[model samples]
Target chain A: DVKVTQSSRYLVKRTGEKVFLECVQDMDHENMFWYRQDPGLGLRLIYFSYDVKMKEKGDIPEGYSVSREKKERFSLILESASTNQTSMYLCASTSGPAEKPQHFGDGTRLSIL
Target chain B: AQTVTQSQPEMSVQEAETVTLSCTYDTSESNYYLFWYKQPPSRQMILVIRQEAYKQQNATENRFSVNFQKAAKSFSLKISDSQLGDTAMYFCAFEGGGSNYKLTFGKGTLLTVNP
Candidate 1:
C-alpha cells in the first residue's frame, strides 16, 4: 500500500499571513501534485512536480506556489493567506507510469480568517 | 486542453439498490485513461475503477463497474447493492497518454446511500 502523508489535517491562519502545507510520500513516486477542492468546482490543480526542483503551474496557480526539494516531499506555500483561500487541500503522488492512479493523502482543511 | 464533466451534482439510492453516476469528457487525444475516484467524508481519495480508451471492454471492480463509450467520450459508474459505506463524493477524471500524468477531474457527484 502507498502512504501519502500531509503535515496537517487542519489549519487556521489570519489574513495576510503566510502558510505552508507539507506532504510526504513513502512510495518514492516521481510525480507529486497539489490540488484545492471546492464545492461545485471539483479538484483544481494548483501545482505539480515531476521531479526534484521541477515544477509546473496547474489551472489555479495564482496566490500559491510549491516546493519539491527532495524526492519524497512536496510543499505548498500560500504567499498571503486570505479568506477565500480557505478550502480543502489535497496532495497526491504517482509513479512513472502515466496510466497509474494517484495516491492521495487525507487532505488538509485550511481556514483563513 | 482536456476537460471532464459530471452533470449530476447529487444522487441518492437505497440500500441494496443500484445507482449510476454519469461522466463525460472533451479531449482531442485518442489514447487516454478514465478513472472513478471515491472520497468519503474526511477521508483520502481512492480509486474506484479505471478504463483505457483502447480497450473495448468495460471495466469492473466487484460491485462497481463502468460503462465506457470511447466514441461518445462517456464513462459512467454503476454501483450495485449500494451500502451505507458507499456514500461519498465520486469524481470522474481523465489522463492523456505519454509523459504528462496530469489528471483533469470533473466537479464530482455527491452520492448518498439511504438505509
Candidate 2:
C-alpha cells in the first residue's frame, strides 16, 4: 500500500506567523501536489513538484510556496500567514501519467488566529 | 481548461439501500479520465472508482460503480447496499491525458447513510 504522511494533523498558528506543512511519500512517485480544501471550493491546488527543487504554481498560489529538497519530502510554506490562510491542507503523490490516481495523505487542519 | 460540476451538495440514504451522486463536466479534450473520490471524517482522500474516456463500459468496484455518459459529459457514482461507513464527502474529478496530470475537482457532495 502507498502511504502519504503529513507532519501535523492539526495545527494552530498566530496571524502573520511563518508556517510549514510537511508531506512525505514512500512510493517514490515523481509527482507531488499541495492543495487546500475548503467547504464549497473543494480542493484547490497550491503548488506541485515534479522533481527535486522544482515547483510549479497551481490555480491558487498567492499565499503559499513549496520546497522539494529531496525526492520523498515536499514542504508547503506560508510566508506570512493570516486568518484567511486557515484551511484543511492536503498532499498527494502520483507515479506519473494521467491514468494514475493520486494517493493522498490524511489532511492537516490549520487554524490561524 | 477542464471543469467538473457536482450538483448535489448533500444526499442521504438508508442503510442497505442505494444512492447515486450526480457529476457533470465540460471539456474540449476527448481523451481524459474521470474519477470519484471519497473523503470521510478521517480526512484521507480515497479513490472510489475511475472511468476512462475511451472505454465504452462503465467502471465498477465492489459496491461502487460509475455511470459514464460520454456525449453528455456526465459521470455519476452509484453506491449499492449503502453502509454506515459510506458516509463521506464525494468529489468528482477530471484528469487530462499525456503529461498534464493535475486534477480539476467539483465542489463535492456530502452523503450520509442513515440506519
Candidate 3:
C-alpha cells in the first residue's frame, strides 16, 4: 500500500504569522501537489512539483509557495497567514503517466485566528 | 484548457439504494482520462473509478461504476447498494492523459446515505 502523510492534522496560527505545512510520500512518487479545499470551491491547486527542486504554480497560487527540496518531501508555505487562508490543505503524489490514481495525504486543517 | 463540472451540490439516498452523480468536462484534447474520487470525513481522496477517453467501454470497480460518454464529454458515477459508509463528498477529476498528470477537479457533490 502507498502512503502520503501530512506533518500536522490540525494547526492553529495567528493571523499574519508564517505557516508551514509539510507532506511526505513513502512511495517516492515523482509528482507531488498542494491544494487548499474550501466549502464550495472544492480542491484548488496551490502548487505542484514534478521533481526535486522544481515547482510550478497552480491556479490559485497567489498566497502560497511550495518547496520540493527532496524526493520524499514537499512543503507548502503560507508567508503570512490570513483569516481567508483558513481551510483544509491536501497533499497528493503520483508515480507518473500510466494513468495511476493519485495517493493523497490525510490533510492538514489550518485555522488562522 | 480543461475544466470539470459537477452540477449537483448535494444528494441523498437510502441504504441499499442506488445513486448516480453527474460530471461533465470540457477539453480540446482528444485523449484524456476521467475519474471519480471519494473524500469521506477522513479527508483523504480515494479513487472510486476511472475511465480512459479512448476506451469505448465504461469502467467499473465492484459496486462503483462509471457511465462514460465520450462525444458528449460526460462521465457519471453510479453507486449501487449504497451504505452509510458511502456518505461523502464525491469529486470528478480529469487528467490530460499524457505527461501532464495534474488533475482538474470539479466542485464535488456531497452524497449522504441514510440508514
Candidate 4:
C-alpha cells in the first residue's frame, strides 16, 4: 500500500502570516500535487512537481508556491495567508504512468484568522 | 482543454438500495481515462473506480461500477446495496493520455446513505 503523509492535519494562522504545508510520500512517486478544496468549488490544483526542482502552476496558483527539493517531499507555501485562504488542502502523489491513480493524504484543514 | 461535470450536487439513498451518480466530460483527445474518487468526512480521497477510453467494457469494483459511454463522453458511477460507509463526496475526474498526468476534477456529488 502507498502512504502519503501530510505534516499537519489541521492548522490555524493569522492574516498576512506565512504558512507551510508539508507532504511526504513513501512510494517515491515522481509526481506530487497540491490542491485546495472549498465548499461548492471542489478541489482545484495549486501546484505540481514532476521532479526535483521542477514545478508547474495549475489552475489556481496565485499567492502559492511549491518546493520539491527531494523526491519524497513536497511543500506548499502560502506567501501571505488571508481569511479567504482558509480551506482544506490536499496532497497527492502518483507514479510516472499517466494512467495510474493518485494516492492522497488525509488533508490539512487550514484556518486563517 | 478538458473539463468534467457532475450535474448532481447531492443525492441520497437508503441502505441496501442502489444509486447512480452522473458525470460528463468534454475533451478533444481520443485517448484518455476517467475516474471516480470517494472522499469521506475524513477528508481522505480514495479512488473508487476507473475507466479507460479504449476499453468498451465498463469498469467495476465490488459493489461499485461505472457506465461509460465513449461517444457521448459520459461516465456515471453506480453503487449497489449501498451501505452507511458508502456515504461520501464522489468526484469525477479526467486524465489525458501521453505526458500530462494531471487530473481535471468535477465539482463533486455529495452522497448520503441512510440506514
Candidate 5:
C-alpha cells in the first residue's frame, strides 16, 4: 500500500509567525499537492509539484508557497501565519496522472492564534 | 475549467439501510474521469470508486456502486446495507485526463449512519 505521511498531525502557531508543514511519500510519486479544506468550500488546491524543483500555483495560492527539493518530500510554507490561516491541511501524492487515485496523508489541523 | 457539485450537504440513514449521494459536474471536455472519495473522522482520504467517461457500465466495489451518466454528467453513489463505519464526508471529484493531473472536487456531503 502507498503511504503518505505528514510531519505534524496538529500544530499551533501565533499570528505573524512562520510555519512549515512537511509531507513525505514512500511510493516516490511524481506529483504532490497541498490543499486547504474549509467548511462550505471543498478542497482547494494551494500548490502542486510535478517534479523536483517544479511547482505550480493552484486556484488559491496566496500567502503560501511550497518546496520540493527532493523526490519524496514536499513542504508547505506559510509566510506569515494569521488566525484566518487556521484550517486543516492535506498533502497528497500521485504516481502519474490525476486519473490515478491520489494517496493522502492524515491531515494536519493547524491553529493560528 | 471544470466544476463538481454535490447537491446534498448532509444525509442520514439507519444502519443496514441504503443511501444515495448525488453528484454532478460541468466540463467542456469529453474525456475525463470521476471519483468518489471518503474522508472519515480519522481525516484520511480514501478512494471509494472511480469511473471513466468512455465506459458505460458503472463501477462497483463491494457495497458501493456508482450510477454514471456521461451525457448528463451525473455520477451518484449508492451504499447498500450501510454500516456505522460508513459515516464520513463524501467528495465527488473530476480529473481532466492528460498532463494536467489536477482534480476538481465538490464541497462534499456529510453522511451519518445511525445504528
Candidate 6:
C-alpha cells in the first residue's frame, strides 16, 4: 500500500501569520499535488509539481505557493494566513498517467483565527 | 474545462439494502475518465471506482458498480447490499484526456448507512 503523510492533521494559526504544510509520500511518485477542500466547493487544486523543482498553478493558487525540493516531499506555503484560509488541506501523489487514481494523505484541517 | 455535479447533498440507506448516487458531468472532450472517491471520517480518502469513456461496460468493484451513460453524460454509482462501513462523502471527479494530471471534482454526496 502507498503511504502519503502530511505533517499535521489539525492546525491552528492566527491571521496574518505565515503557515507551512508539509507532505511526504513513501511511494516516490513523480507527480505531487496540493488541494484545498472546503464545504460545498469540493477539492480545488492549489499547486502541483510534475517533478522536483517544477511547479504549476492550479485553479485556485492565489495566496498559496508550493515547493518540491525532493521527489518524495511537497510543501504548501501560505504567505499570509487569513480567516478565509481556514479549510481542509489534502495532499496527493500519483505515478505515470492520470488514469491511475491518486494516493491521498490524511488531510490537514487548518483553522485561521 | 470539465465539471462534475453530484446533485444529492445527502442520502441514506439501510444495511444490506441498495443505494445509488447520481453524478452528471459536462465536457466537450470525446475521451475522458470518471472516478468516484470515498472520504471516511478521520481517515484517508480512497478511490471507490473508475470508468473510461470508451468502455461500454460499467466498471464494478466488489459490490460497488457504476451506471455509465455516455450520451447523457451521466455516471451513477450503485452499491449493492450496502454496509454500514460505506458511510462517507462520495465525490465524483472528471479527468480530461488532454490534461490527465488535473481532476475536476463535484461537491460530493454524503451517504449514511443505517442499521
DockQ, each predicted model: 0.80, 0.79, 0.73, 0.77, 0.76, 0.73
Per-residue error at B38 for model 6, in Å?
0.4
True contacts kept of 3: 0.57
lDDT of 6 by residue, B1-115 (tens): 7889999999999999999999999999998899999999866889999999999999999999999999999999999999989999999999888773788899999999999
The local distance difference test score of model 5 is 0.94
**Docking outcome class, model 6:** medium
**How many backbone collisions does model 5 have?**
0
Positional deviation of B71 in candidate 5, in angstroms? 1.2
Clashing pairs in model 4, backbone N/Cα/C closer than 3 A = none
Residues A1-113, candidate 4: write the lDDT tens digits: 99999999989999999999999999989999999998888889999999999999999999999999999999999999999999999999999665579999999999999
Off by over 4 Å in 3: none
CA lDDT, candidate 5, residue A53: 100
Which pairs of residues clash in candidate 3, taking residues 3 or more apart in a chain or in different chains? none
Estimate every model's Cα lDDT from 0 to 1: 0.94, 0.94, 0.92, 0.94, 0.94, 0.93
- Which RMSD values do the candidates have, in order? 0.9, 0.9, 1.0, 0.9, 1.0, 0.9
lDDT tens digits, residue span A1-113, model 5:
99999999999999999999999999989999999999979899999999999999998899899999999999999999989999999999998855578899999999999
B86: Cα error in model 6, Å: 0.4
Candidate 3: C-alpha RMSD after superposition: 1.0
Among incorrect, acceptable, medium and high, the docking class of model 4 is medium
The model with the greatest DockQ is: 1
Q: Please give, for residues A1-113, the per-residue lDDT of candidate 6 as tens digits.
A: 99999999999999999999999999879989998999888899899998999999999999998899999999999999999999999999998575678999999999999
Q: Looking at candidate 1, what is the lDDT of residue B24?
A: 98
